[model samples]
Target: MKKYTLLLLTIAATVVILIQSILYIKAGASAGKTSGVPAESLARLSEQVSVRAARRGNPWINLRDGRDLVAELTGADQGLLAGEGLAEPMALASDDFDEDGTPDLVTAHRAAQGGVLSFYRGNVDAVYPNAPEAKARKAAGSYTDAPFLSPGRLLATAEPPDLLGAGDFDADGHRDIVAAARGGSSIYVLSGDGRGGFPRSKQIQLPGRVTALTAGEINRADGLADIIVGISTQDGARALVFEDLRGAIKAAPESHALPATATDFALGDFVDGYETDLAIASGSQLLVLHGRDRRSAKQSRPRITSRRFSSAIESLATGNFTGSHRFEVGVLSEEGEIAALTPVKVKSKN
Candidate 1:
């Protein structure tokens, strides 16, 4: 008798929820009708709800929100050796090195002579305002990689350093270069002069070989950007936050230990917070560390080789590649291949 009563209550509660939802939607529809919205518009709104229900099952697919986005690998750089592995450092720089209106893709390879930076200019027609910028360009030779400046380059290099994270380091309205030394406690800074050139680089000394870098306002409220870098240590990995105090960017007095030899560091609000959180790939695994808002981070035991979560990730970045408020992960595999993973929707187990 008690079980029967409980079942009846559950059914009644579900019916009430359904009726409330229906009435709420109808109220909205009635408002649209009062505002002289056509029945076709309301039907489209109803279709959108059905579409969203279908989208919840597969987050990998792009939205049907009237955007012409196709979720697929549209292009790849086959000739350039992205990297031998995480051991070998390489970077793909996407920016307008010359401050031109068009975007350019710079390819950096670590060399004995400091390092070498090359450019591949983005197609102006593909990016120009008069032209429509589709997610996938379809014109003949539309998406080919061409040498950007014929011969313009950074000319600055590092100690086999894999430096990335480009931004306006000085609020100078020009893109600047930030990188970490993989074998030392130094961070390289090169100020772009708006042209396809940079001034003599400056070094911000930290602790250990700086392997990873992600730029944001990690420390300052002055509206300028700061940086967070990952360094390898004898114990594990430590993250150093450098804020742009005044006009000059300086390293924070101390660092925090993030264990397991961090590599490919990224920043986002992973676990719900106003400040940013950290994500890294280390030893064939992805690690998420809470931000300063939390007391500490969750630590897990190392998994076996066969059950490894990643294929020895060489690099990674997080962004909302799709048309959603949520972000996505792009990983560089050890075999010099790039992989993009859309966040999957999984039901929580109570």
Candidate 2:
């Protein structure tokens, strides 16, 4: 009986070891596959797959089958902005304005019309009627007829306003406009007024030139939108949080100084299970500023996660990529190299 029991115990231990060996082999294979491919190539391929799938009106597709494989343009000259006539497009925003399931594209032109913010309602249809051959196309003409708030008198001056953001700032259903003028160092809050047109409201002045601005619901509430403004000066760039109270901007407690030269900021859920955090792009680096707990008397500074990049980052946007939350930092250099960063894995997890 003792010999039989020993045999059974040995077999069970062998089975456990076999299972672990199989898991390690599977994990190593996945790591090898990912490591063999360059990050840039992976990013490009992922984008191509997404675009191709999107054009087919089916964003969700099984990667294993690969039946819907289609050739995609990975070059910068690809007609992503065909018929848009957008010169030096610096900033891009995506939102579902029409309550449609898909989001629309809004591009901010840096040169044309002296720096106008052009809103293009992205058509989900694979073939845009205007550009039947192209997958994506921009709407015609200026959505906002007036000149963007800047120092110059040009109807569409692009002096690079201190800040620009789009959200329901005034608690209205429609997305209102919010811009900070570089010359005046003031924040202009526009109210939707429950109508289609936005009426300009009071302009609040800040200490320095606004470099970046973003809107998000940080407190997990729904009444008004929260504004995150990055101010750049000779000293350094600092981020300020303001509560949008029906067109009036009030400073929030999260307003604090940061280390780098903040250029453009974005709000999104960085940590999978935690609340949204502010991601700031400073020069060629991206920094993640986690929200602070107000209850802590020790006064812990905002947690900063820095990631280096090859090119100078001009702007940033945070959204879900491959079902995991990620950030797409836009680089505005002559070299068209755009990259997205995902969470790095630890060796202990393996």
Q: Pick the candidate with the highest TM-score.
A: 1
TM-score per prediction, in order, is 0.54, 0.51
| Model 2 regions lying over 4 Å from their true place | 1-163, 172-174, 181-184, 219-223, 244-248, 252-254, 292-300, 322-338, 344-350
lDDT per residue as tens, model 1, 1-350: 99999999999999999986665443333222213323222111122232334455465764443321111111223222334542333776576656545565655667644555554434343323233221122232222122222222334455544666676677777777676556668777777787656775787877577767776554213455567777887777876666544433543433656545667767665444555655666656565544543122113221111113446777777887756677656667687766544442223211
lDDT of 2 by residue, 1-350 (tens): 99999999999999999986665454333222223333222211121232333234345644331131112222222333234564465555455443333343344445433454444332233212222212111132111111111111111322543356666765656666566544446666655443223445556677777767777765334445678777876677777777544432544435556666676777666654345566777777677766544343125555567766687677665655445535433334225666555552112210
> Cα RMSD to native, each candidate?
16.8, 17.4
Clashing pairs in 1: 114-157, 115-157
Deviation in Å, model 1, residue 200 alpha carbon: 3.5
lDDT against true structure, model 2: 0.49
Residue 289 C-alpha lDDT in model 2: 66
